[model samples]
Target: MREVEETLAHNLREVREKKGYTLKDVVKGTGYTEVSISRWETGTRIPKATVLYNLAKFYGVSVDRFFWR
Candidate 1:
């Protein structure tokens, strides 16, 4: 589970950076705080399914993108 979380964190950060979006930009679009986003990207916290869905939508990718390939 920890490995899965880490993979998700990496993927999330990668996708965000690839899209040229800052944490503040994600916060504005996803209604998630920068702290929360940071935590998620750092693997210190895991987002709920709905949150994941919302993030996927915001990034224009499938939720599976956050998982190991």
Candidate 2:
């Protein structure tokens, strides 16, 4: 479970960066703070469903892609 969580975080960060979005951009788009994004990316915290939805919309990707391949 921990490994899967970490993988999700890593993939999320990779996708965000690949799209040229900064933490500030994510915050602006998803209304989540930079600290939260940092925590999520570092696997220190798990994002809530709403937040994940917002992130997926902001990145124009499916929420499942953040977890699954």
Candidate 3:
């Protein structure tokens, strides 16, 4: 639910930052727009499962790690 979505966003944002990627960089990696990345980081919208999977894969992490502790 909302908590899981928030966790996903938080983890994705953290991982992106740890890797020194700007939102624009993530957008290029995910083929999602910079606005979409911003929305996710800001908790404005939860990304689709496919988008999440692509992001996790792009970061070389499992989908489980993207949303869970």
Question: Per-candidate RMSD vs. true structure?
Answer: 0.8, 1.0, 1.3
lDDT (10s digit) by residue, model 1, range 1-57 = 788998999999999999999999999998899999999999999999999999999
Instruction: Give stretches of model 3 more than 4 Å off.
Output: none
Model 2 stretches with alpha carbons more than 4 Å out:
none
* lDDT per residue as tens, model 3, 1-69: 788778877888998898888988887777899888889877898888898788888888888877666
At residue 28, candidate 1 shows an lDDT of 94
TM-score of 2: 0.91
Which stretches in model 1 have alpha-carbon errors above 4 Å? none
Candidate 1 lDDT at 52 equals: 92
Best-to-worst order by lDDT is: 1, 2, 3
Query: Candidate order by TM-score, highest to lowest?
Result: 1, 2, 3
How badly does each model clash, as a count of residue pairs? 0, 0, 0
On TM-score, the candidate that comes out on top is 1
- lDDT score, candidate 1, position 33: 96
lDDT at 20 for candidate 1? 96
Global lDDT of each model? 0.94, 0.89, 0.83
